[model samples]
Target chain A: MALNFLIQLLVNGLIIGLLYGVVAMSFVLIYKSSQVVNFAQGEFLLVGAWACWWLLAKFAIPFYLAFLLTLIFMIIFGILVQIIILKPLIGEPIISIIMVTIGLSIFFQAIMNWMFGVFTEPFPTIFNTESIKIFGLNVQTAYLMSGLISIFIMISFALFFKKSRLGLAMRATAFDQQAAQSLGVSIKQVFAAAWAISAMVSAVAGVVFGIVNGISSGIAFMGIKVFPAVILGGLDSVLGAILGGLAIGLLEHIAHYVDVQFLNVGNLIRIAPFYALIIILMIKPYGFFGTKDIERV
Target chain B: MNLKNSRPCGDFRTSYFKDMSMFEDKKGFFLTCFGVFILSCSPLFLDSYLISLLIYIGFYAIAALGLNILVGFTGQISVGHAVFFGFGAFASAWLNNSFLIPVFFCIPLAAILTAFIGLLFGIPAARVKGLYLAIATLAAQFIMEDFFSRASWFTGGVDGASAEPLKIFGIFFDSDTKYFFIVLFWMVVSFIIATNILRTRDGRAFLAVRDHYLSAEMMGINLMKYRILSFGISSFFAGLGGALYGHYLNFVSIEEFNIQLSITFLAMIIIGGLGSIRGSMMGAAFMVLLPEIMDWLTRSLSGTSIDSALSLSEAIPFIKEASIGLVIILFLIFEPNGLAYRWGQIRAWFKLYPFSY
Candidate 1:
C-alpha cells in the first residue's frame, strides 16, 4: 500500500515538475538573450490564463480556440512589452532593469486584480475525462494533458534551437551579443523573439495550471516557487530547468508525505524547496547545468 | 576627485579634511538644520492623518536607508527584504508580549536578532553574486515566511500577533502625534548611523566591492565579511522599522510581509536614489505620498477627461501600481541615478545660472 502511494506521489510530482519547468523555461528564455531577469514572468502566466479563461467563459469560445487566441495575444503582448518598456532599458544597470521588471510585476498583478476581481475561479473542465486510473492509481486528466503538452513543447523547443535559423541567431546572441551583432544578428529581433516565445510558453503553463488547479491572483506566486527549480537546474540552462523542476516537485511531495506520515510538521512542503536550494547553492553555485563565470583581477 | 562636469565651479578644497566634510559650505549645513527644525515642529500644526503618514514615511526611510547600504553601497540586490522586516516585527512582538521587555530594549534586541538572521541568510552570498544572490535571498524570504506561518505559538500563525502599545518611561505612545515623535527619533538615529558608517572604512570597502569586486579583492578586502556585514546592517534597520510598524499598527501579521512589501521597499530606494542617503529618505516620502496624491488626482479628474465606463475607485489600485511601475521604469531609463541625482543637477544649474552649462 505504501509503495503504491509512493508511486502515486511520483506521478503527481512529475506532472507538477513539468508545469514548473514550463514557467522556468519562460524565465530562462528572457534571461538567456537579454541578461534581464524578468520578475514579471509570472504575471505573463497570470495574464495568459486570464485571457484564455475570459475568452472561454465570457465569450463562450471553445477551449482550443480560446487557448490559441490567448497564445497569440501573449506573443504580441510579450513583443510589445519588450519593445516599449524593455528596449529603452537595454544599457541600464542590472538593478535598474530588475526594478523595472519588479515594477511591471506589481503593475500586472494590480491590473489583473482589477479585471478579474479578487477571487479564485475554477477553470472549465475542457478535458472529457476528469480522472483516469493509471496502473491502479488515480491521475488527474488535466495534469496528464498538461504533462504531455509540456513534453511536446520541450521536444519542439530542443528541435527549434537545434535546427531553425532564428534559433541559431538567438543562440549566438545569448553566447555573445557583440560577436552576434558583428555577425549581423539583429539583437532587437532576437530579444523580441525571445520575449514572444517565452510569453507563449508561460501562457501554456498558466492555462494548464489554471485547468489543473484554479485561476487566481495567487497563481502569480508560481514565479517565486519556480525560481528554486530554475536555480536548481542552473539559471541559464533550459535542460537544467526541466530537471530542477522535477527535482523540486519530487522534493515537495516527499516533504509533504514525510510531514504527514512521520514528523507531522506543518508547512514543511512549502519550505523544502528553499532548503534544497540553499544547500545546492552552497555546494555548487553555478548549479548542475549553469556555466561557471570565471572572474580575474 | 571631481569626476563629473556638473559639479559647481566654486567647490574647491585645499585639504583632505575640507574635502571630507559633510557639507561643502555653511549654507548647506544651516539649511539642513532649518529643515530638521521645521520637520520636528510640523506635527503641532498638521492634522493627525498627515502625522500618521509622516510616521510611515519615517519608518520606510529607515528601511530604505538600510537597503541602500546593501544594494547601493554594496551592489547586492535583495528582493526579499520584507522577510527581515517581518522578522523584526514578530521578534519585537514576542519580546514585548512574552518577556515583558521594555519598548526601548525590545526594538534593539529585535534588530540584533534580525541582523543575525540576515547574516545567516547572507552565507549564500559568499558563493554567489548579482542575480544569483537575489534568488538566494528570495529563498531566505520564502523560508522566513514559512517559519512565521508555521510557528503559531510565537508568531500567532496566520491570525497574526498583536503588539503592545509602546511606552517610554511613564508615557504611552498611543496617539498618532505621540507616535510620530518615536518614529522620527528612530529615523533620525538610523540616518546618523548610516551616515557615519558610509564615512568610515567599512563603507569605503562596500563602495569598492560595488564598483569592482575583482579589484576590491585585489586590494585585500574581505569580501565575505563586508557582504555579511552589509546584510546584517540592512536587516537591523529592517527589523527596527518592522517593529515600529507593528507598534504603530498595533498588530503584526504574516500577510503584511509578503513579496509585494519587499518590492515596495526596493521601489522606495530606487525611485529616491540608490547610493545617496538623502535619496533614501526622499524615496520613502515619495512612495508613501504617491498613492495618496494619485487617489486625490483621480477623484478630481474622474468621469471628466478619463474613461466613463470604469469607476475611479475601482481603478485607483491599478493606477497606483501602474504609476509606481511607470515611475520606476521611467526613472531607470531616463535618470538611473534617481531623484537625488536630479536634485544635484538642479543645484548645479542654479549655482552656474549665468553660464547654465
Candidate 2:
C-alpha cells in the first residue's frame, strides 16, 4: 500500500513537473537566444489557456482546433511583442529590457482579466476518456495524454535544435550575437522566431496546466514560480529546464506529504521550489548545465 | 574657482557658509525650508483624508529613501523589500501586544530586529550578483511572509496583529492630524540622515561600487562589508517606515507588505530618478498620491455607490497595477535617468539663461 502511494505521488509529480518543464523550456529558449528573461512567460501561458477555453467552451469549437488557433494567436502575439517593444530597445541596458517585459506581462494580464473576467474556467481535454489502470494503479486519461504530449514536444524541440537551420542560427546567436550578425545572420529575425516559438510553447504549457488544475490569475503567477525551475536547470539550458522541472515537482510533492505529518506545514510546499532555487543559486550561480564566464571584477 | 568656468551660479556658492549649507545656496535653502514648513503645517488646514494620504506619502518616502540607497547608490536590486517592511510591522505589533512595550520603543526595536535579518540575507548577496541575488532576496520575502502567516505565535496567524494607539510625550496620537505630525517629523529626520550619509565615506563607497565595482575594489573598498551594511541600513529605514505605517493605521497584516508594494516602491525610485535624495520625496508622493487622486476620480464617476461600482473597482486594482508597470516601462525606455536629470536640466537652463550657443 505504501509503495502504491509512493508510485502514485511520483506519477502525479512527473505530470505536474512536465507541465512546469514546458513553461521553463519556453523561458530558457528566449533567455538562451536573447539573454532576456521573459518575465511574462506565465502571462503568455494564461493567455493561451484562456484563449483555448474561450474558443472551445464559449465558441463551441473542437478542442484540437481551439488548441491550434490558440497556438497561432500566441505566436503572432509573441512576434508582435518582439517587433513593437523589444526591437526598438535592442542595445539598451538589460534591466530596462527586463522592466519592459515585466510591463508587458502586466499589460497582458490586464487584458486577460478584462477578457476572462477573473474566473476559473474548465478547459476541455482533447481526449475525454476514462482513467487507465496500469498494474492496478489508476491514472487519469487527461494526465496521461498531457504527459505524453509534453514529452513529445520536448523531444521534437531537441531534434529541431539539432537538425534545423533556424535552430542552428538561434544557437549561433545565443553563442555570440555580434559574431552571428557579422557572419551574415539576421539576429532580428532570429529573435522574432525565438519569441514566436517560446509563445507557442507557453501556449501549450498553459493549456495543459489549465486542463490539469483549472485556470485563473494563479496560473499567471506560475510564471514567477517557474523562475526557480529555469534557474535550477540553468537559465540557458533547455534540457536542464526539463530536469529541473521534474526535480522541483518531486520535491514539492514530497514536501506536501512530509508536511501532512507535521503541524500543518503544507503551505510551505508552495515555497519549496524557491527554497531549492536559492540553494542551487548559492552553490552554483550559473546553474548545473550553464556555461561559466570569468567574473570581470 | 575659475570665473570663466564657474560663475558661482547665483547665490548657490557665494560664501564658505553657503557652500557648506545643505541647500548649497541661500535661495534653495530657504525654498526647502519653506517647503518643509508648508508640509509640517499641512495637517492643520487639510481634511482628514488628505492628512491621512500625506501620512502615507511620508511613510512611503522614508521607505523609498531606503530603497534608493540599495538600488541607486549601491546598485542592488531588491524585489523583496516589502517582506522587510512587513517584518517590521509584525515585530512591532508583537512586541507591543506581548511585552506591552511603548509604541516608540517597539518601533525602533522592530527596525533593529529587521536589520539583523537583513544582514543575514545580505550574506549571500556578497557571493551572488544580479538576478541571483534578487532571487535570494525574493526567497527571503517568501520565507518571512510564510513564517508570519503560518506561524501562529509570532504574527497572530493570518488575521494579523492589532497595533496600539501611539503616544508621544503623554499626548495620545489618535487623530489623523496627530499621526501626520509624527510621520512628518520622522520624514524630515530620515531625509537629513539619508542626505548626511551620502556626504560620508560609506556613502561615497556605495556610489563608487555602484559606478564601477572593480575600481572601487582596487581602491581598497570592501565590497561585501559595504554591500551587507547597505542592506542593513536600507532595511532599517524600511522597518522604521513600516512601524510608522502600522501605528498610523493601528493594524498590521501580511497583505500590507507584499511583492506588489516592493514593485511599486521600485517604480517610484525609477520614475523619480534613482540616485537623487529629492527624487525620493517626489517619487513617493507621485506614487501614493496619484493613485488616491485616481481613486477619487473613480469614486466620483460611480456616484458614491460602491456596490454599483464593484466591477469598476475590481478593474481599478488591475489598472493601478498596470499603470505602475507602465510607468516603469515608459521611464526605462525614455527617461531612464529619471526626474532628477530633468530637474538638473531645468536648473542648468535657468542658470545659463538668454545665451544661445
Candidate 3:
C-alpha cells in the first residue's frame, strides 16, 4: 500500500515538475537576454491565467479562442512593460534595477488581487474526461496534457534558439551587446522580443497550471519556487532549468513520503527546496551548468 | 565625498578635528537639536493615536537605517532582512517569557542574538556577490521563515508569542504615548551609532568595499570580513528595531515577517535614498504614513461615483499595497538618489537662491 502511494506521489511529482520547467525556462530566457532578475515572473502567470479566465468566463468564448487571445494580449503586455518600465532603467545600478522590478511585481500582484478578488477561480471545463488510467496509475487529464505541453514547449524553445533568425540575434546580444550592436543587431528589438516571448510562454504555463489547480493568488508563488530550480540548473541555462525543476519536484515528493512514513512533521515539502538551494549555493555556488564569471577587481 | 559641497557659505574647518566633527557647524547642530526637541515634545500635544504612529515610524526608521548600512553603505543586498527583523522580535519575546529577562534588557539581548544569526546567514554572502547573493539571501529568508514555523518553542508556533511591556525600575511602558519615548531613544541612538560608524576607519572600509571590492581589497580591507561584519551590524539594528516593534504591539506573530514586508523595507531605503542616514528615517516615516494617508483619502472619497463604482472600500488594502510598488518604481526611475538627495538639492537651491550656479 505504501509503495503504491509512493509511486502515485512520483507520478504527481513528474507532472508538476514539467510545469515548473516550463515556467523556469521563460524565467531563464528573460535573465539571459536582459539581465534583470524579474521578481514579477509569477505575476506573469497570474496576469496570463487571469486574462484567459476573464475571456472565457466573461466573453463566454471557447477555450481555444480565449487561449489564443490571452497569448496575443500577453505579447503586447510584455512589450509594453519592456518599453515603458524596463527601458528607462537600462543604465541604472543593480540595486535600482532590482528595486524597479520588485516594485513592478508588488504593483501588478496587488492590482490583480484587487481586480480578480482573492478567491481561487477554476477554469471553465475544457476536458471532458477527468482522469485516465496509464500504467495502472490514475492521472488527471489536465496533468497529462500539461506534461505533454511542457515537453512540446521545451522542444520548441530548443528549436527557436537554434534555428530562428531572431533567436540568433538574441544569442548574439546576450553574448556581447557591443559586438552584437556592431554586427547590426538592434538591442531594443531583442529585449522587447525576449520579454514578449517569455510572457507568451509563461501565459501557456499559467493557463495549464490554472487548469490543474484552481487559479488564485497562490499561483503567483511559482515565481519564487522557480528560484531553487534555476539555482540548481544554473540561472542562465535553459536546459538546466528543466532538469532542476524535475529534481526539485521529485525531492519535494520524497520528502513528503518520508514525513508521512516516519517523521510525521508537516510542511517539509514547502521548505525542502530552500534547504537544497542553500546547500547547492554553499557547495557549488555556480550550480551544474552556470558559467563561472571571472571578475577583475 | 566632497566635504565642501555640504557646508553652508562661510563655514570653514581649519583642522582635521573640526572637519571630522559629527555636525558640520554649530548652526547645523542647533537645527538638528531643534528638530529632535520638537519631536520629543509632540507627545504632550498630540493624541495617543498620533503618538502610536510616531512610535511605529521610529522603530521602522531604526530598522531602515540598518538596511541602509548594508545595502547603501556596504553594497550587500539582502532580501531576508524581514526574517532577521522577525527573529529579533521572536528572540526578545522568548527571552522575556522563558528566562524572565526584563523586556528593557531583552531588546538589546535579542539584537545580539540576531546579529549572530545574521553572521551565520552572511556566510553565503561571503561566497556570492550581486545577483547570486540576492538569490542566496532569498533562500535564507524562506529557510528562516520555515524555522520560525517549525520551532514552536521560540516563536510559539502558529499561536505566535507574547511580549511584556518594557519596565524601567518600577515604571511600566504600555501606552503608546509612553512607548513613543522608548522608540525615540533607540532611534536617536541607532542613527548616532550609524553616523559615528560611517566616520570611522571601519566605516570607510565598508564604503571601500561597496565602491570597488578589488580596489578595497588592494587597499587592505578584508573583503570577506567587512561584508560579514556589515551584515552583523545591519542585523544588529534590525533586531533592535524589531524588538521595539514587538513590544509596542505586545505581540509577535510569524505572519508579520514575510517576503512582502522585506520588500517593503527595501522600498523604504530605496524611496528615502539609498546610503543616506537621514534618508532612512525619512523613508521609514514616509512608508509608515503612506497607508494612513491612503485610508484618509479613501474615506473622504468613499461615496464618490468612481469610489462607488470600484467599491474603493474593499479595494483599500490592495490600493495601499499597490502604492508601495508604485512608489518604489517611480522613485527608482525618477528619483533614484531618493528623498534625502532631493532634500539636499532643495537646500542647495535655497542656499544659492539668486545665483545660477
Candidate 4:
C-alpha cells in the first residue's frame, strides 16, 4: 500500500515538476537576457491566469479561443511592463531593479485581489472526460496535456535558441551586451522580446496550474517557489532550471511522505526546498551548470 | 539671516572638533531640543490614536535605523531582518515571562542575544555578496519562519506569548501615555548612536568595505569581520525595537513577522534615504502614516460614485498594500536619494531664492 502511494506521488510529482520547469525556463529567459531577477514572475502567472479566466467566464467564450486571447494580451502586457517599468532602470543598481520588481509584485498582487475577489475560481470545465489511464494510475486529462505541452515547449526553446534569428540575437545580448550591440543586435528589442515571451510562457503555466488546482491569489506562491528551483539549478542555465525544478518537485513530495509516516511535522513539504536552498548556497553558490560569478579583483 | 545657523554652502570647519560635531551649530541643537520637548509633552494634549501613531513611528524608526546601519552604511542587503526583529520579540518575551526578568533589563539583554544569532546567519554573507547574498538571506527568511512556527515552547506556540509591561522601582508603564516616554528615550538613543557610529573608525571601515571590498582588504580592513559586524549591529537595533514593541503590546504573535513586513522595512529605508539616519526616521514616519491616509481617502470616497460601484470598504487592505508598492516605485524613480536629499534641496531652494534652478 505504501509503495503504491509512493508511486502515485512520484507520478504526480513529475507532472507538477514539468509545469515548474516551464515557469523556471521563462524566469531564466528574463535573467539571462536582462540580468534582472524578477520577483514578480509569479505575478505574471497570476495575471495571465486571471486574464484567461476573465475572458472565459465573462465572455462565455470557448476555452481555446479564450486561451489564445490571453496569450496575446500577455505579450502586449509584458512589453508595456518592460518599456514603462523596467526601461528607465536600465543603468540602475541591482538592488533598485530588485526592489522595483518586488514593488511590481506587491502592486499587481493587491490589484488582482481587488479586481477579482480573493476566492478560488475554477476554469470553466475544459475536459469533458476527466480521468485517463496513464500506465496504471488514473491521470487527469489536464495533467497529461500539460505534461506534453511542457515537453513540447522545451524542445521548441532548444531549437529556437539554436536556429532562430531573434533567438540568436537574444543569446548574443545575454553573452555580451556591448559585443552584441557592435554586432548589430538591438538590446532593447531583445529585452522586450524576452519579457514578452516570459510573460506568455508563464501565463500558459498559470492556466495549466489553474486547471489542475483552481486559480486564486495563492497561485502567486509559485513565484517564491521558483527561487529555490532557480538557485538549485544555477541562476543562468536553462537546462539547469528545468532539472532543478524537477528535483525540487520530487523533494517536496518525498518530504510529504516522510512527514505522514514518521515525523508528522506538518508543512515540511514547503520548508524542505528552502532547507535544500540554504545547503546549495552554502556548498555551491554556483549550481551544476552556472558560470562562477566571483571575480577576484 | 544668520549664516552660522542656516549655512547653505561652503566649508567653515577650523578644527577636528568643529568638523566632527553632532550638530552644525547652536541652532540645530536648540531646534532638536525644542522638538523633543514638544513631543515629550504630547501625551497631555494629543488623543490616544495620535499618541499610538507616534509610538508606532517610534519603534519602526528605531528598527529602520538598524536596517540603515547595515544596508545604507555597510551595503549588506538583508531580506531576513524581520525574522531577527521577531526573534527579539520572542527572546524578550521569553526572558520576561519564562525566566521572570524585569522588562527594562530584558530589552537590552534580548538585543544582545539577537546580535549573536544574527552572526550565525551572517556566515553566508562572509562568502557571498550582492544578488547571491540576497538569495541566501531569502532562504534564511523561510527557514527561520518555519522555526518560529515549530518552536512553540519559546514563542508560546499557537496561543502566542504575552510580555510584562515596563517596570522600574515599583512603577509600571502599563499605558500608551507612559510607554511614550520609554519609546522616545530609545528613539533618541538609537539616532544618536547611529550618528556617532558613522564618525568612528569602525564605521569608516564599513564605508570602505561598501565602496570597494578589494581596496578595503588591501587597506588592512578585515572584510569578513566588518561584514559580520554590520549584521550584528543591525540585528541589535532590530532587537531593541522589537523588545520595546513586545512590551508595548504586552504580547508577541508568530504570524506578524513575514516577507511583507521585511519589504515594508526595505521601503522605509529606501523612501527615507539610503545611508542617512535621518532619512530612516522620515521613511518610518511616512510608512506608519501611509495606511491611515489610505483609510481616510477610502472612507471619504465611500459615498461617491466610485465607492458605490466598487465597494471601497472591502478593498481597503488591497488598496493599502498597492499603495506601498506604488510609493516605492515612485520614490525609486523620482527621489532615489530619498526624503533627506529632498529636504536638503528644499532648504537650498529657499536659501538661494531666485538663483535656484
Per-model B-chain TM-score: 0.95, 0.90, 0.96, 0.96
In angstroms, give how far residue A113 of model 3 lies from its true place: 0.8
Q: How many angstroms is residue B327 displaced in model 3 relative to the true structure, after the best TM-score fit?
A: 0.7
* Poorest 10 consecutive residues by lDDT, candidate 3 chain B: B4-13
Candidate 4 wrongly placed segments (more than 4 Å): B1-8, B354-357
Q: Give the worst 10-residue stretch by lDDT in candidate 2 chain B.
A: B5-14
Please list the residue runs of candidate 3 whose C-alpha ends up more than 4 Å from where it truly belongs after superposition: B1-14
- DockQ, ranked from best to worst: 3, 4, 1, 2
lDDT of 1 by residue, A129-238 (tens): 78999878899898889899999989989998999999999999999999999999999899999999999999999999899889998788888788888888888999
In model 4, which residue pairs have backbone atoms overlapping below 3 Å? Answer: none
**Each prediction's whole-model lDDT (CA):** 0.88, 0.82, 0.91, 0.90
Query: For all candidates, what are the clash counts?
Result: 0, 0, 0, 0
The stretch of ten residues in a row with the least summed lDDT in candidate 1 chain B is B1-10
lDDT of 2 by residue, A1-297 (tens): 656777888888888889888889888999889878687888988988898888888888778788899999999989998888787777776556666787778777877776677878766656656689977889988788779989998999998899999999999999999899999889989999999999999889888888877889778877887888877888889988999888888888777766665556668568888788888888888888877766943
What are the DockQ scores of the candidates, in order? 0.64, 0.58, 0.78, 0.72
User: Model 3: per-residue lDDT, tens digit, B1-357?
Assistant: 898656555446789999889987778899999998999999989999999899989998989999999999999998889998999999999999999999999999999999998888776688788887888888888988889998999999999999999999899999988899899989989989999999999999999999999999998899999999999999999999999999999899999999998998999999899899999999999999999999999999988998989999999999999999999988888899999999988887887776726
Superposed on the true interface residues, model 2 gives a C-alpha RMSD in angstroms of 2.0
lDDT: worst 10-residue window of model 4 chain B: B3-12
For candidate 4, lDDT tens digit of each residue in B56-101? 9999998899999888888888888888988999999999888888
lDDT of 2 at B262: 79
Residue pairs of candidate 3 with colliding backbone atoms = none
Worst 10 residues of 2 chain A by lDDT: A257-266
